[model samples]
Target: MWDYSEKVKEHFFAPRNAGAVDGANAVGDVGSLSCGDALRLTLKVDPESETILDAGFQTFGCGSAIASSSALTEIIKGMNIDAALQVSNQDIADYLDGLPPEKMHCSVMGREALQAAVANYRGEEWVDDHEEGALICKCFAVDAVMIEETIRANDLSTVEEVTNYTKAGGGCSACHEGIEEILMKVMDERGETFDPTAVAGEIKKPTSGLTNLQRMKRIEELLEEIRPNLQRDHGDVELVEVDGKYIYVKMIGACAGCQMASTTLGGIQQHLAEGLGEFIQVLPAEELARRAAMGA
Candidate 1:
């Protein structure tokens, strides 16, 4: 059994504002029985002031879900609409002293429902595909955009944290690999270390169809993808040679002599390894020059 915090248990056992608000100006509903959680939030606002005069909720899920919804209602009760909108899943968790990581999604549900209600109240229709990209988690109808947004917003670094925030890998776990890929992509976009070792499963071996030239082309393509990022800081990289499984490259401009040069080289190696295979090594020009000077 999970250890429920005292505040969580108190809210779960006796949820405040547990019913619907009469004559609510705005209402938002999200989740489903199939998804294992649902929330309906109704708010009565002082239209002139746009202040949330009262808030109420009806949640259908576990104890955490109920507590989350109840906590959300209490948090937004007297705040202006704009201020209320600023509340996040983390805010809900903090309000309840804290939540178990696995139950974090319950707070997410509360936050989403609140956003929806706010949109509905404002008569704003967001027809845009907020959930663009391929569906990655069929069990919860979650897409790559949802997972990516959750990961970036929460600074989620592990598969478990992603699962806790978005419920992406909480089902049969078939989509865990895809989730991992998205996590890596996000980390790369943020210019962070892309640690393949941190992820579960072995690094995939290069397939037989990849010829030597094709593999080299792939490496160049990946470097080209990273070139713009380096250029932003008055830096660049040039490919010196692709010798067998080794890639010899030289960093240019600011990146060449920076203390982070090795870190940059390591990042390149990790990126290529993620695509090509673990055998691919990226060596900086200085490292090769030192080896040659030593006559090794």
Candidate 2:
């Protein structure tokens, strides 16, 4: 089990504000794409007093995120609009007594939702409509700074490489093509000394360095070609990696999203690996997710 902070647990159990408001003057909805946590905050305002009358929240999230939303509603109720807007992520964290680092973003989300609600009350859009800077990390709403730090810290060999290290485009994958373009530009300017020929070598079979995007494409291609064949047997397969010439595969699909996935990944996986090569390693996707979770 994760070591949740005491405050997180407390809020999870006896959350401060866990209901809907009778009459809300403004409502704000915020969604986190990475964790798929969504929240709606409603505020009832007193026009003459220029203060909040009541606040409530409806949240869909893990324990910490839900707790953060609950706590936020309690803190903001009866506060003036500007006063509520002054509440920060730090204040939320402090009010909760503190949250886990991984859960810290939940506090940020609470603040953003409150601010957005107030922004809505004032009739303003939070996001810049006109183009300013390109999205550098699609998975986490990260901008140029996040990508730049990863590139500089690891001296990234390629964009796909960044994915393995940071899990940037590992989700949804819509940002991969754009990420590729961004990395190339950054690397070119960062004294990589571009040469078309050697650069071409780096472009092909990038998994040698555990680069991210290329390997994802390669594995995705391997899955696309091979999975269809396995589907006939009512099985599943996932191509993971090659260690020294040994190819690895994991089973999923009807197998994983159902009860008999274990039997399929085990018995059927070996059968498929037998035909693939002697060096093939076939395992369950759960096993893979486990190994990944354990940093194996």
Candidate 3:
């Protein structure tokens, strides 16, 4: 249940340029039924001036998609072909006032179709100028080029923003890690520095001079904070004891036999490290026992 803006509602209900132009010299098509959206864009261009004489669209998508295609045509009409190349997904969204975050992909579709149509007009192969990297988001068949372009165009920082603009990590969520990698890479390329874990809400370990007893107390406090989330999954954790930098813990309840116990343990350890200090390490009861047996 998304709230469509007045302009979105207007264009969706009565989409302008809803049909294609006959004998059009340039045409671009993108998306598919399987992808949940499709668009066919036809352009009539002045051969000498290279200005867009007319633009029309045949869109097969949701309300936002239709509005986006219609809006794109209106924006590019009477503009130079070179100028039209600069129109971004954000521009399309802005033209329609603003779109809901989830519906931003519809605008992305418009930009892609426009690029394709322009390429067709030039008699050149469609080339993405944003990214020349590997395919990261397989769910929606989005590659790094599309994701990177959207991020750069909109200055997106968070995974949520990437998902909003490109629909990359929105499905299945297996590619979230890959999306994060690309985000960091792009940020680095822009000479911006950030704590990589900050996107996931992970705090970097702070340096603090404290006694062993104080450190143990702090670890207990952090564990208390994380316990509630584990409890919701019928899982629980107990502090065995703190030995030097190693904070040993025992998994109980469903967590004890859960196949994902190791993953949960790693998450807990990472949380502790971030909250306390990187020096603080977490080990399971079994690991502690084995280490003690080795006399090391």
RMSD of each: 13.1, 16.2, 16.7
Candidate 2, residues 211-261, lDDT tens digits: the string is 556544654564565465456434567666554434456665544564444
Give the C-alpha lDDT of model 3: 0.80
Q: What does candidate 3's lDDT look like per residue over 1-296, in tens digits?
A: 77899999999998887798867889999873333798999999999999999999998898999999999999999999999989988789888987875576788789989999999999988865433345677554577777887778877677866764555675678998888888888878888764445554444545546777787788889899778857744578999988877889999886797665765676677667767755577788989889889998
Rank list by TM-score? 1, 2, 3
**Which candidate number has the best lDDT?**
3
* 2 versus 3: better lDDT goes to: 3
Model 1 Cα shift for residue 248 (angstroms): 31
What lDDT, from 0 to 1, does candidate 1 have?
Answer: 0.78
In model 1, which regions exceed 4 Å deviation? 32-34, 126-296
The Cα error of candidate 3 at residue 155, in Å, is: 21
Q: What are the Cα lDDT values of the candidates?
A: 0.78, 0.65, 0.80
Instruction: In candidate 3, list every pair of residues with a backbone clash.
Output: none
**Which ten-residue region of model 2 has the weakest summed lDDT?**
198-207
